[model samples]
Target: MSNLPLTSNKLLSTLSSSDYERLLPHLETTDLPLGQTLYEPNQPLNYAYFPLNAVISLVNILEGGQMVDATMIGNEGMVGVPLVLGTMQIPMSAVTQIAGQALRIEASIFRSTLQGNGALYSLMLRYVQVLMGQIAQNLACIRLHSAQERCCYLLAMMQDRVGSPELIITQEALSRVVGVRRAGVNEIVNTLGRAGLIGHQRGKITILDRAGLEAAGCQCYRTLRAEYGRLSRP
Candidate 1:
């Protein structure tokens, strides 16, 4: 029997049984630790990862080493899209934003499978389109939203991805992921805590009131969720 766990990953789980079987032999379960670098800027990808509960951040570094988080991939998507789509090198760096497990497959095998002109290829193309939409939405959010609104949106999104109200992440790390300064992150966090919208400890946060958070966050979150729901549906 194949040892792969009953996958919670949206992409993999949505695959047709025949498509799943075709890819099964190449998949191996892997532990994705926090802060793990999956790929670096301009680096050749070796594998694609479908995260079950983990979240990966794609960061783009500026000339002076200022890094901005471009997008995030969780259970709904896979890493190494460029590899399967014909690009040999990835432009952004990918790192684990939260610790969890993923099913990984060799990039070569994945690419060969993509050439089969089957359901998997079509599905991956749709996923890539949805992922691009997320990136575009983030760009708009960053330009038009406040730090507090963005923070709430981010926390709310993480809650959905992790399937829990509570999350284990330090403020410093959160700041990096949100592309905000530590003081700004603290200010937003403090506001949320004071309002009882969320509970924050040293390195953990819990969503005490999802409704409150939804009200505080930007509309981009809802729009993004709707798009993902529409595009990623089986």
Candidate 2:
């Protein structure tokens, strides 16, 4: 019970006992390391991952090799959403942002199970809506908000997902996600550090004042939270 990977995930936990039992045999526990590429742009998805403790990023890589995160999936959601809709290809990159374990299922099995499982299908549909809202909010945030505000927004989101004050990620990766230069990210981090909102160390950041960080972010952060909360309700 305690060692079961899917048991702790919000999405999997909501499944009916019988449905979970049917899929349990197909679930394989796997470790996702930091910076691991789950899927590349326009590539076939071999499996669907339901992360138990990992965080995955959906990033859009530009022609210039720059990347910007479109959305994030964790214990609350499943990756390889295209498999459910009869498509195995995605234009964005799916990468492991946090090293942890997940229940990886064959794409074919997941798709077949989802087709006959009303509860699972409906839950995934709701998650898709919530994810769309987050992506839209992120677009607006990037276009209208300052770098500092965006940094705060990212930190607040990471804190919510990981349920921890300490996040282990590099400034280079942070810059890519926020669509900014490394120097720009450094400046924002320095500002947050000086304001006592966060403490920075090599390859890690510790949130010192979550409330203050949220206060520094734009309304997009709150809007995204409300949308996800509404869709996630049982």
Candidate 3:
């Protein structure tokens, strides 16, 4: 297959023509399968990824083996922000939540591009603000929203990122993302399904009614979408 749609990433698509041409040769497409760790906390990041169709999950792993999701990076955002900030260490670990493609560049090379590339730097700055907003909104959503509402929001968000009704997630993983117990997640799942919002079996969940799912979710989903979707591109 041809390597088409390299600018499919919203962040990269905003690049100016000259900067894009200069950076093009250094970019490489890489496969990101489910559960693949892109970067771990306080570790060296080999590459920064600009997702094409994948959604990378950022999570905070507690000392006792518990994991809580921080935020997700889809085609609208790029990973490895810490590299541009003069650090390789971050508190959250980034892992692939949805299997798909991404454009990756070596961290060192990317930094070199920043040496006077105004557009890329400005874009990344805007991206950081977007990321911070997402994290804050998600924290509030988790604390204030009901489990069922949050479940609806999460499933809806995943559908948006994957651009398909099908979602590759188990109840266990979904529970982690929604910050709820597995049993609580099961109840939410049944509720949404009975309401004709979604369908699920094993490691897959499919959005059955997008409109209904949106109605079922909390306001945070809409907020995230507005901030991180169409308006997110620089």
Which ten-residue region of model 1 has the weakest summed lDDT? 1-10
Give the clash count for model 1.
0
Question: What does the lDDT come to for candidate 3?
Answer: 0.85
User: Which digits, one per residue and each the tens of the lDDT, describe model 3 over residues 50-156?
Assistant: 98888899999999978988988888888999977877778889999888889999999988887768788887888888888988998999889998888888788
Kindly give the number of clashing pairs for every candidate: 0, 0, 0
What lDDT does candidate 2 reach at residue 103?
A: 89
Model 1 / residue 20 / CA error / Å? 1.4
CA RMSD for every model? 2.4, 2.3, 1.9
- How does model 2 fare in lDDT? 0.84
- Per-model TM-score, in order, reads 0.94, 0.91, 0.93
**Preferred candidate (lDDT higher): 2 or 3:** 3
Q: State, as a TM-score between 0 and 1, how close model 3 is to the true structure.
A: 0.93
RMSD (Cα, Å) of model 1: 2.4
Candidate 1 residue-wise lDDT, 1-234, digit = tens: 123354678778888788888888888888888899999899889999998777889999899988888988888789999976898688889999988788899988889989984788888888899899999888888889987888888888888776678887889889987769999899889999999999999989999999999999999889988887876454
Can you tell me which runs of candidate 3 are displaced by over 4 Å?
1-4, 229-234
Residues 1-234 of candidate 2 have per-residue lDDT tens digits of 124446757778877798789888999998888999999999889999988877899988998997878878777778988886689899999998876778899988888888888888888888777777778888888889998898898888877666578988899988877779999999999999999999999999999999999999888788877776676465
The residue ranges of model 2 lying beyond 4 angstroms of the native Cα positions read 1-5
Model 2 worst lDDT run, 10 consecutive residues: 1-10
Ranking by lDDT: 1, 3, 2
